[model samples]
Target: MNQNKLQSLMLCLLFYSNVSVYPVTPETIHIIISEDKTMLSEWEIPEELTLDTLESKIGTHDRTNETEDSIKYIWDHLGIVAKFSKNSKFLNKLTVFYATTLKNEEPKQNFKGKMNFFSSDPNQKVEATYKGWICRFKLGNRSLYGICKGENRNLEQIDILSK
Candidate 1:
């Protein structure tokens, strides 16, 4: 082959190799919150947990029932996590950590916090910001805030924009 053609071929190969590839193997992270008698849980790790898993494990209903909204929210967020990991690196890291923690810890009672959405693209960076006694545990500069109040209120909220 001509030298110019050979050089062009090598350049093409180099370009292809340099393209970023996301991690395919699913990594799971779990987070648990409990206060008094109330307990809240979230799983974000494992990029493989699909919409089906979320729907089945947490019920695939809209937030209509005051009694079941919390559970429905959890599954909805899980679906969001699956979608988010497809694009954002920071979100993947956060979900992985969150899921792992929840998977390991035993359920508890009386914990209050909010899960806030964060993003770290090629543009901006953020650190955990807390209000009052609330402690923010950030992952990849992004977060999904949740808060459990006393033994009666167990809230789990997920930020849809994390991805």
Candidate 2:
């Protein structure tokens, strides 16, 4: 092969080898919530997804809701609060606050980050800025929530959900 062709071939092989050595991890979990603010799909956050890692992945501000037992980071843009337990050192809970009520009693087709948990819905520490529909579920708890997109509900992944 020509010198240029050989170099190109070597580069391709190197790229492919590296990719196989280190596979990319899935970052986002696609989910859909019902209009009533219940999770219609199942979502198990990976163990590696801690508060620190989350903040790094999705930038967060200084605003926080903290106590002796737990710490929460609220991302206004993402409309989600990731809660971590003090002793466990992992993301123990997730609460997603909606921006607006379901249109016509149905989940909105798109989440534009326009809505938030109603003032009354949030914990006292965050009530000042948080405000719409709120859905809170614990990770690895007996009660589980499913993932849905505000589109349809077949409940196909039933095994992942809790009774």
lDDT of 1 by residue, 66-160 (tens): 22211112222232222323332222211211222232121121112233333434344434444543334355534545332334433332332
Native-vs-model 2 lDDT?
0.41
Model 2 residue 129 CA deviation (Å) reads 30
Number of residue pairs clashing in candidate 2, backbone atoms closer than 3 angstroms, sequence gap of 3 or more or interchain: 17
List model 2 lDDT by residue over 108-139, tens digit each.
Answer: 32223221112232342221111122222332
What is the TM-score of each predicted model, taking all chains together? 0.24, 0.37
Over 4 Å off in model 1, which ranges? 1-45, 63-136, 139-161
